[model samples]
Target: MISIPFSGSKRNRYKEVKQIIQDNGYKKVYEAFGGSAVLSVNLFREGLVERAVINDYDRLFDLYPAYLDIKDTLIQKCLEAGFIKSNKRLNATQRAYLQSMIATIDEKYWRLLANNFVFSGKQTGSLKPLYFTYFHNDITTDKQREYLQTVQQMERVSMDYKAFLKQYFKDFDDTTMIILDPPYMNSTQKAYDNRYFFGLSATLQMLQMVKEMQVDFIFFNMIERDVIEVLKVFGFQDFEVSTRRITQTSTSSREDCLAYVRNHF
Candidate 1:
């Protein structure tokens, strides 16, 4: 039930993905591209996984210690600074205060709080001027406190997915499942920041490496021809899941494919 305001988060597809993992009887989950780490934490919480490793290239991992140690303090500071209270959009004065806090506060706290304010839970990974949004639903302090509790048991690491997989994939056993949710290979849109934009070549290289390693994995990505072909070449079983993309102007339905390789190694 922990909600992280991260762009491209898998929270919506968690139940489906969790069922896949559970059916495979995977007791440990390694979230190779752990954006928001929705699967890792929730799987651990629900007792599907005895161990979870959350790894991401983004600096968001740097804020985990802050959340673990001083979440109450962070919430209190936000409350005192008028950052949280209602489901209303920020006013001009409140915006000014938030801008100042982003300018002056330490990167860890500010970046963590920045997630709650950005439009559509999209992060830019910069201290640049932020596009503000309404505070409501899961973006409240009470919800944050509840969410923070779920992450305490997870092991967090900040590293490029290639390096992370190279280092740890060798240690995985039959009970381990590596969840690969890399950035979309067909989209140029920057989800979190420039660092998150994984080009087609890089995506192919990652897929090739995963194939060579012969480890069990569940991969999530948009239904692109090249990606589907590559997964097919690797002998993965494909399942397409329908999803919606919500923009400021409209919402459109799209299909996202989940490809998995079971104990075929």
Candidate 2:
């Protein structure tokens, strides 16, 4: 899996989830909330899924086409704007420059710039770049090439989960699988700043819709009693539990689960 600098990335657990899909004999896959597109990219690289549908309501999808079609210009703009080769905390001048870039650059490239450079890969806080001191030393030509190549090879869609489901996965059979990683109920505001967030009510509705669609799925979220109860209400009795070590601290951890739902017969 690629090292993506996005909030809520599941890079560490990609192998486990991929194994789950393989074990269940699902060859076609859809990702409803492709935040960092990490899982979809990994599946694409590993050839686990024959048809991979990557969809997201966020502007992050814009990066796919931009990276694939206009690679040189995108990298050149980042370099020219000092988004690359520097990791200083955003000063007044640097902040102003970023705002200007946000206005002028296409939404996809701007999304990449903000998330890749900003602290915690989040756009909510003060615009502090990812690395304070070793920023320049960390990025290399090889990493950039790998990222761009992965983006170019992906099949990306820019749309809401419901729309994508209705359009693509509505007729999915047992061989098809969908991965649903909606905003966690407990960390909606913290991880995504309430932007593009699927709140609890919306999440419940989506869950019901998924149940009705009858497509096989694996849902991921931070474990909580309320969420578990709701899953049980939807006939989800079993879950694959795991520990997620939060990046901000080593001692802190969260119980996470992958709730698998097989297709209706």
| Top-TM-score candidate index | 1
For model 1, give the 10-residue run with minimal summed lDDT.
240-249
Over 1-265, each residue of candidate 2 has an lDDT whose tens digit, in order, gives 6655553547777878788878888888888887776787778778887877788566564555454344345345656767645555656665665455455555445434543445543544343322221223334345555765775677777776888899985558888888888877766353442355566777788889988887778787776565667778888655544545455445565656666666474
Model 1 regions more than 4 Å off: 7-9, 65-89, 107-111, 121-123, 126-139, 190-193, 224-226, 235-254, 263-265
Residue 242 of model 1 has an lDDT of: 39
What root-mean-square deviation over C-alphas does model 1 reach? 3.8
The runs of at least 3 residues in candidate 2 whose Cα sits more than 4 Å from the true structure, single-residue gaps closed, are: 64-111, 115-117, 125-137, 188-197, 249-253, 263-265
Model 1 TM-score relative to the real fold = 0.77
**Candidate 1's residue-wise lDDT over 139-233, tens digit each?**
34565546567776678787878889888876788788888887777655535345455766667788788777767777777765655687676
